[model samples]
Target: MELTTPTGASILVNLADDFIHGFAKMKVKRIGYGAGQSDMDFPNVLKLYLGEASGRRFNHDEITLLETNIDTATGETMGYLFEQLFEEGALDVVLVPCIMKKNRPGHILKVMCNQADVEQLTALIMEETGTLGVRVMPHAHRLTLSRRIVEKKVVVGDREFKVRFKVAFDSAGVIAFERAEFEDLRRISKKTGLSLRKVREELKS
Candidate 1:
């Protein structure tokens, strides 16, 4: 796809929502919005649909750094660090063996998690290990397709809930889909004498 700017320059892009083998092609249908954080420099909204393009899309970006070297920590101690991090719901944890200053063999522990967990986890690391400090950086969060729906019911006797696409992606990979709220779902189920799952499924359909 190509876009003409006010200056008369053209910008081009190509991407796909998914691949359908042996098919001619799929074109973009629409874009959907999700949400945004108040303090974000970039829009917090999620885009639901992808536009039509001639081919598949690829992307990469530059980034800032956050690193530190620790020489005195032990293997058993490192195990504790990883366990604590995992218990706290860290995104990732790894340790690379390396030779540090004075040619001492050691491990370079790397921990990666959401920006929100950095401060508290860093404090835990400092308190639990010999590392004196941590390096911090402002990072970027990627937007992806996500959605959920719940059944919301009228007080009289209906089950339904609004399903808006969310900015945060769920493991099932839905951008926006339907749902049924419990309160309404329960009442609807009671009124119709149907199981909760059956009521939810019917309402979704």
Candidate 2:
């Protein structure tokens, strides 16, 4: 853009990079932008008009992503892998099922962690499980979190199982999650005389 004064002299500057610099040199009363020609090389570039109003400051930015997939695996092993991730450095770990390549059944393992540790965690998973090379990528983690576990005793014949009900809570403190894994609750119930409902109810009493 070229700015001309009544003196018949003008200044020419590239509006993109020189906008802030030029504005800082002269007194800026306002700043704005108009539709700029799209560049094939840079999808995000845009031109700016600066007359400027505010004082100066700069800022930094960042992004985080967690990704993993498991197809040739089992529920028990997957549970263990999740636990291992938490132990290693993961903030959160979860499993999602999806139909993968060639229409094979699979689980998408999403793990939240710093970018630096993703590789180690992926390597651990590959070493522990017979899975092929892990597929990792950047992803977002929008989590409202809490922790709770309810122990229930389920009876199957003479055996007792100590099953656990895990529920995650949201900011409102309501249970946002509930997972009842026959996770041994049946074993404890059968060994003891207490019923499943009794054990669950005992949590309150």
Candidate 3:
């Protein structure tokens, strides 16, 4: 039987650091099971184990970092450039105000993307900003934690709104931190006439 799908295999290949021959020492913290729709003679469930490992706990991945200095682009042009970069699948983008050569005020545009996207994104940057050169650093190491998004309906005063929370988990399957989606919070605040800070506080309580 074909037990593993292509998507599942791809995820394991990219995310797994190493494959063990047998079980290693582990402090079991949490377990999850997924079942198929049809009932079989034997158990048809996939088991997932989350626990503490003796060595490294955090996940790591490689990414390409692209940076360019823009001294002539206007604020509006930079803003549109950022919007387009994100829409084109940039992992993250940052614009930092800085003093360039000759002490001229400018902004540093930094972009992070998958290694395969370096060529396309670099071209996009040059096309948008008219910059002659971009600094491309490949294979940049990044440490990361397991993360997931959960959605729930939250009631604030007389109104109920749906909100999604971005949750990050540590090595032991414990929640490291979580936060409500900013857009949902902003929507709730606008509808309820509550300040953004107050909306967050209310949601916490």
**In terms of lDDT, which candidate is strongest?**
3
Q: Which ranking of candidates, highest TM-score first?
A: 3, 1, 2
- Candidates by lDDT, descending order: 3, 2, 1
Measured with C-alpha atoms, the lDDT of residue 23 in candidate 3 is 80
Residue pairs whose backbone atoms clash in candidate 3: none
**Residue 195 CA displacement from its true place in model 1, Å:** 42
- Native-to-model Cα distance after best TM-score fit, residue 103 in candidate 2, in Å: 4.5
Q: For model 3, what is the C-alpha lDDT against the true structure? A: 0.88
Residues 15-115, candidate 2: write the lDDT tens digits: 23433433354355555554435445444333444553343222222324555567778888888888898999987787889889988888888776777
Residues 30-141, model 1: lDDT tens digits: 7678674454666556555665643323232323223456777778888998899878766677888888989888877677677667777888788777789787655644
Candidate 3 lowest-lDDT run of ten: 51-60
Q: Which ten residues in a row have the lowest lDDT in candidate 1?
A: 56-65
User: What residue runs in model 3 are displaced by over 4 Å at the alpha carbon?
Assistant: 1-56
Local distance difference test, each candidate: 0.60, 0.63, 0.88
